[model samples]
Target: MLYRPNPPISFTGAVLDRADHIRADADKLAELMNWRARLLRLDGLDPVIGDDGALVWGTLADAGEHDELVFLGLDESGRACFAPVSPANKGNPGPANPRLWGAMASLPAGDLATYGGARALVDWHARHRFCARCGYTTKLGKGGWQRKCVNMDCKAEHFPRVDPVTIMSVEWEGNLLLGRQPRFPAKRYSALAGFVEPGESIEEAVAREVHEEAGVRVRDVRYVACQPWPFPSSLMIGCHAYADDPAITIDKTELEDARWFTRDEVVYAMEALKTGAEDGAFIAPPPFAVAHHLLKWWIEQ
Candidate 1:
């Protein structure tokens, strides 16, 4: 599917992502430790507090010496900035929680994803302060990879999480199935989606979520693509499914309305928004949204 590339940072897994992986490693970043955790107050920068209640922008001092891989947060124009931390007057600047700064969801979407990972790590540390088994506070271990319980008797380790969900555009006859939740804005409908439960396959999730959310029976479910949705972290698995029938039964609790849209109508709604046409009546999601991707594929088909 082709559309304008969403800017700030393209989260799509592609050749460009190779650079991200190379940069994701914090080991190489330690080389900058001498410059890390400098008092931004001295530099005329007032540190901001993040959503997690931690003052943002601290040097990753805990990151060992001579490392060069530093994960950076970029602005809308792709200019990168050092996420600074607290304890500025001297000494090792206290670790500032960058995660707290990530809550400004209105920022550009690419920054949201980048800082979302940072915040997820910080949140993980704050929440896992203690071991579930021994109640002993844990320590950040393995270069922010794991949290090890401090109590020797009940040592426990925890890792970052990414919940997986299956989202699908169901097709039957010549119409594409779409649904609108009560919370959706007027004229907004999106693909049916639900988290993949333990022991459930992607195909199973597509079939199950379709039936549970819309009472529609799916015949064949095929995986298309996936996106990293980091609103507290979730991997959205996109798919296309064939519905067995055209009958609609609404799951009122989950969706306000469930129905089918002809490919022409989908195209009209999108093109209307694109060309500023007068008669275009439908409202689709933003270009960055997975719903837009699904619609792009549908219209192309």
Candidate 2:
């Protein structure tokens, strides 16, 4: 079931949603002020983790004064939820303070989705505090979902956005094409990806990215599963394509190296990445990324 449709893909199926009942009722908004509601305290953009490698969910009593309070959807148990951004100096700490990727891998599917949504929403609020039309500050509305400008003359509203990116695995002549960027870790390589341009389709973006990076033309672009990559906020559209030509012509600007690997080599690299073996000449992206799932699908094929 490696490529199964419902395999716990990271940041995908969020159970706690904004149903019509919850949105229309005024009582639901009062849940944020309740003492029993769970709170996820973030230090700037980083989440606070406990000693057991899980995100620390605290009550109102445990959190310090926060700047913004975002209503993250309820948990699986149907409890009210909120994520408050603590001041930079007041973050909770434990034995280790891991970043988003590491914390995501250790969390359950529901928690991961909740955290991703909260992070994206919180980041949007942090970046968009003022209206573009007027120089007036905006106020949170719709239970922290919308921001409206305070100026009576220009009441501009803003909503959160998720950038779409196309990530694909290109295959030709029984070999898969992978590339490494200059900033990537030493000896690590993964699927090719690029942002979708204005008025461009996902399939076109996949083919264009493969050609632009590796000088390879791809066709038969097929849709695969997708992941919500919430680094800042992006929806990665996973795909699989077939390369028409196998010749390697690396784009020095986009990638440090681009080469084709046989199925066996890819299989070995995947195993090494899973076991954290450093001896291998090639290392795959970590399992938390959609690139890893793309590689895993190719290996299963």
TM-score of each: 0.69, 0.88
What lDDT does model 1 reach? 0.59
Alpha-carbon local distance difference test for all models: 0.59, 0.77
Residues 1-301 of candidate 2: C-alpha lDDT, one tens digit per residue: 3376435678877867654355435587775457777888666667677787666788766666655566776666666777764434332222123355577778777667777787777777777778988989987766667788999999998887788999999999888899998988799998988989998999989988998888899999988778987767789998999987798788898899988888888888899976877876589887777888888887777
Top model number, TM-score: 2
lDDT string, candidate 1, 114-198, tens digits: 4445444444444555677888877655445567787887778777567898989899987889888887767877888898999
> Which portions of model 2 show Cα errors greater than 4 Å?
5-7, 13-15, 24-27, 61-66, 85-98, 279-281
In model 1, the Cα lDDT at residue 159 comes to: 73
